[model samples]
Target: MTRVHDMGGRFGDGAVVPEADGIPQLGDWQARALALTLAAGALGQWNIDVSRHARERLSPADYGRFSYFEKWIAALADLLVETGVLTEEDLSGQEGDAPHPLADRVLKAEAVAAVLARGGPSERPSNVASRFEVGQAVRTLRPAANRLVDGGHTRLPAYAAGARGRIVRKHGSHVLPDSNAHRLGEAPEPLYAVAFPASELWADPEAPGDEVVLDLWQSYLEPA
Candidate 1:
């Protein structure tokens, strides 16, 4: 889907800003949202990729306006209902019979601090070797599909789609997020670091150091 989120090569305002002032990374509500998301994941309901797609599926307007954690919260809220774990009433603080999502393994407040410190892992073993190798020329896949109607997640960004690039490095085979997000199991695939020229994506001057290197899966690329 072509959206503002894919700002790979666009020329920005080029506004210079000061260094970090040490403000909190997340507000109170966002902190709560993160906790809920992590707690839900502990239950084995949905994977990180699914939650990512849920955020990406949001309307463009909402997506552009939402902060990073806001998107996370929205996605978590949606997934809860999608998995039949909770209903609108349950979230609204109304009395309902919806089973506690974490009834089997409740997330204690004290444990929340520890859980967030150690992030969730999603590495799957691969039985097959990677199709493409480092230094190989490749072209990205360009599909006319949107998550809202098409129903899936993709790591391929719009600007990089259909563009040719060279595989700078191979990150080895890992769980294919597209399939994992859909609950189709890991479906391991190769991941590569592809370097695309700035001119190719933005039609701008290809400075000697100006380039976009993105991590893309094997499914998104083909031999050029």
Candidate 2:
């Protein structure tokens, strides 16, 4: 699971460059990529987290070279094939069976803004109490030496794995991506804003005094 995507704090990638170019706008392909991802979601085959994880699973070469929306389109294709909606051959120029779930309505461009503004909410009721609280010190659990997490779908980033941090705030119970990505279940767990000192994650952090905040779930943390 630990791969290039989690190599943010490591070498090779230089200082975080601010967007110095002019105002950005979606190009033709990027716009279509966004629409396709939304259309596939309307089919009810996979959740948002699953789509994101799929993008992360893209081959390192493609994942590194593809533009942002390209990654989304790639993930969309992966999911469509994964859910039996399409096949590799279908993607490879073959005629594919139509998905008729939302046959009557279409996600028109006119309504794209409204639809995206009303984001998919994942909050769920939890009977279980949180084991940690705001201001609590905790450590992210690392997989055993011989065992890497089976995939990159987990909420715990590889850079932050095994490091200690403090819970700055609790965002209440929400669907855990670790389970949601696998379609195992909602697996709602307490979410927190964990703030780690920059030096903890990198040998020579760009900004030594800054803190790297990550939205971590309960399952990823334990007593420091």
| Best lDDT among the predictions, by candidate number | 2
Alpha-carbon lDDT of model 2: 0.79
| Predicted structure 1, TM vs. truth | 0.83
lDDT, candidate 2, at 148 = 20
Colliding pairs, model 1 = none
Clash statistics: count for each candidate? 0, 0
Each candidate's lDDT (Cα)?
Answer: 0.77, 0.79
Candidate 2 local lDDT, 1-224, one digit each (tens)? 47555665565756666776897778888887887889767766788888878887899999899988888888888898999777788889987567655555666678678878988998788865798988889998885111223653776777888888999999989997877887787878788999999988787778978899999878788888
After superposition, the stretches of candidate 2 with alpha carbons farther than 4 Å from their true spots are 15-23, 96-114, 144-149, 206-208
Residues 1-224, model 1: lDDT tens digits:
46555665566648767777887477788888877777877776777888777887777888878988888888788888898777787788885765674696776778778877877655557876788877889998876233323546777777777888999998878787777778777888778999988777676565855789999888788899
TM-score of each: 0.83, 0.85
